[model samples]
Structures are given as structure tokens and as C-alpha cells.
Target: MQRDALSLSQYIVYRNGVPAGARGGLRNMFHRAFGAATFAGFWRHWNPIFGYVLGRYIYSPLQRVVPRPLALILTFVVCGAVHDLVTMAVRGAPAFFFVPWFVLLGTGVVLGRAVGLDLSGRPWVARAAANLAYVLACLAITLAGECFIW
Candidate 1:
């Protein structure tokens, strides 16, 4: 990715500084990219300024008390709320999409983590299957939002 001029480092999610692709190791580049589809990864990775503040002050502390799934949901909720606040300042009307989008994203991240955890300690094929399922699940969430939430 960095070599191909296609890397989105901050947009990519990391746990303990390891890239999701490095951990998943999908031989196919397409699989690798989508397999790493995560809202927290995107929100926490993109833009160092907000990323550091969010990661250090908000997200990290939340994870201490909450499980990974709950932590992910809370993270997205906070993100959604922040986006809503920012948009509301301009329009001052209830948003129909922003909050729901983050909720859907929270769902995606929780489900993806669940699938990934289930595949842990399994063989390579299981890992690959988990990765595929996770990406498909994220895709489903985004598409479903466009159809129904929009």
C-alpha cells in the first residue's frame, strides 16, 4: 500500500500499532482493504489532531470499563453525537442520517470484532473467511443505510 501510493495509514485502524492488513494477511489487495473496514479505524486513524485527542482522552478511558463491543458502540455514538452537534450548529434541525450512520457503523464494528474474535487461534482459512464476512457485513450496513435510512 505505501509502496503502491494507496496507503491511508491514519484511516486504517490499528490495535497496538499493528495494521489490520498485517494481521489479517489477505493475499489479495482488495480483500485486504475491505477487510480492514472499521469506523473506529477510520475515525481514530485519519487526521492526527483529532485522532490523538479522541484516542487518548475519550476512547481509551471508555475501553477500560466497557467490553470491546460496547466500547466500539460508544465510540461511534460519541462520534455521531459530535457530528450531529457540528451540523446542528449550522442548521439547528434534527439530523436524519448522521446519527444513524454512526449507529450503523457502530453495529458494523461490533459485528466485525465478534467475527474476528471467533476466528482467533483458528487456521488461515478461518481467518480469511472471517475477514470476508466482516467486509461483507460492513458493506451491507452502508448499503442498507443508503436504501432505508436515506
Candidate 2:
């Protein structure tokens, strides 16, 4: 259970980090080519910066309280819950899709840790494997939920 939680948290952080990086890149592009204002660029990069700060100050501090996996799981569940609430309110989508995705993400983190996957060393392969695992796991979970879990 603990391990599961920790994995989830790690996955959440990673997912958020990717999009944040992309946003930051886009902002940088605009600033470089179009002479966008600092304030606008800052706003564009805010997500990544915010995620980094949260992981460093809040998430890291909280992680020490539990085993790595459990910590990840708890953090991810919270993140998933928040996403669900926001999506439901803002987009009127059912909150169910997040559950499976979070579960899959948690599983991926555990597997990666167990295998000692070095994402930085083998970027393309590592990302492909991780993402494939994530997608498959999520699909399976969602299918199960639709068939019986729910």
C-alpha cells in the first residue's frame, strides 16, 4: 500500500513535470522570437516552476514520513482527487478516468524503481517503455472498472 502511494506520487510529479517543461519551452520560444514581456513569459513557465517548488518544499518534506512507495501513492491520490474535482467542475467530465490513470502511474513508478530504470541514460527507450506501461495499465484498469469495479 505504501509503495503504491509513493509510486503514484512520483508518477504525478513526472507527468506534471513533462507538461510544465513543454509550456516553459513554448514560453521561451515566444520570448525569443516575438519579444514577449517578462511577466508573460513568467506566467507561461509558472507551472513547471510551481511543480518544482512544490516537489522540493512540500512533497519532499512529506515523503520522509512514509516509505517511498506509500508516500508516492498518497501524494498521487491527492493529486488525482484534485484533478478530478477540477475537471468535473471545469469540463463536466466524469471523475472516474483519473482513478485508473493514477493507479497505472503508481504501478509504473514501482516497476521503474524495482528495475532501476535510468531514464536519463536512455531517454527514448526509457520513455517509450514507461509510457507504454502506463497506457496499458491504465487501459486495463479502466476496462476492469467499467466491467466490474464500478
Candidate 3:
């Protein structure tokens, strides 16, 4: 598999069109993520820093060994596990929120791609709304699972 040669700073600039510490960087990140036309595109735009590491360190290696769909889901699971670790450390208790949350998001991306979901030609507002809705729906499901199941 080909590796991304861009350094972290370069990746951020390339993805966000601005330097990491530049004013409006956060705004740009949100605009790009929410403005994306698909759920996968949203993940692509969400956090250039985390995405870079996850892509290079986690997803790429898994992709080499597993099927793409399974790799994608496992990547999210690993990412969420890291987040949960931090949450558990900070709260001094076990945390289970992010794993299922990220799993749903990953599944959404897989299903969206399988269905050929694309909103690139739609109006920007419409695209943003759809992307936001997908994210919120995943969060809602995760919250419900946490309350009822976990």
C-alpha cells in the first residue's frame, strides 16, 4: 500500500487549506466537515490530525490484512477505544460511549458507499444538513444504546 508522505503539518494544510494554528482553522475544519456531501466525506474532513494518524497508523495496516469494509469498522473501533481510554482515565471509571458511537458512524459510511449515496450536486445547505443528520442519527443511536443496553 502507498503511504501518505505528507507530514502532519503538511497534511493539515493540504486538507484544511490553512496552517494548523491559523486563525479560522477551526472554522474551516467545521465548514469542510459539515459541508461534505457524504458521511465518508464528513469523516475525511472532520479532524485532519486524527484522520492522518488513523489513516496512516491504523486503517492502512488493517486494510492490508482485512477486507475494506471490516478494516473500516475496525479502524473506527480502535479510534473509539483510544478515546474511551482517555475518558476512562479522566473520569476514573470505565467508559463505553465512543466505541459503539464510532462503530455506527463507520457502518454508516460503509452503507452510504454501498448505496452510492452522493450529494455533491446538491446545494451546500442541503449537503450540510444531510451530513449533520447522519452524524446526529449515529449519536442518537449510540446514546440510546448506552441508556438501554450498556
Better of 2 and 3 by lDDT: 3
Candidate 1, residues 1-150, lDDT tens digits: the string is 221232435433332244445654233333433333443333333443444555555677788998867776777678778887888888988665456666776786666556654433556555556555654666576568769655
The lowest-lDDT stretch of 10 consecutive residues in candidate 3 is 1-10
Off by over 4 Å in 3: 1-3
Model 3 per-residue lDDT tens digits across residues 8-123: 88888877889898998899999999888888888987898999999999998899999999999999999999999999999999899999999999999999999999999998
User: What CA RMSD would you report for each candidate?
Assistant: 8.8, 11.1, 1.6
TM-score order of candidates, top first:
3, 2, 1
Q: Return the TM-score for candidate 3, rounded to 2 decimals.
A: 0.95
Clashes of 2: 10
Q: Name the lDDT value of residue 1 in candidate 2.
A: 21
Write one digit per residue (lDDT tens) for candidate 2, span 1-150: 222344434433443433434555544433332221222222123344444444555456678997777766555565566667888999886766675566565656665667765444444444445555555766787677777756
lDDT of each: 0.55, 0.51, 0.91
Clashes (candidate 3): 0
Lowest-sum lDDT 10-residue window in model 1: 1-10
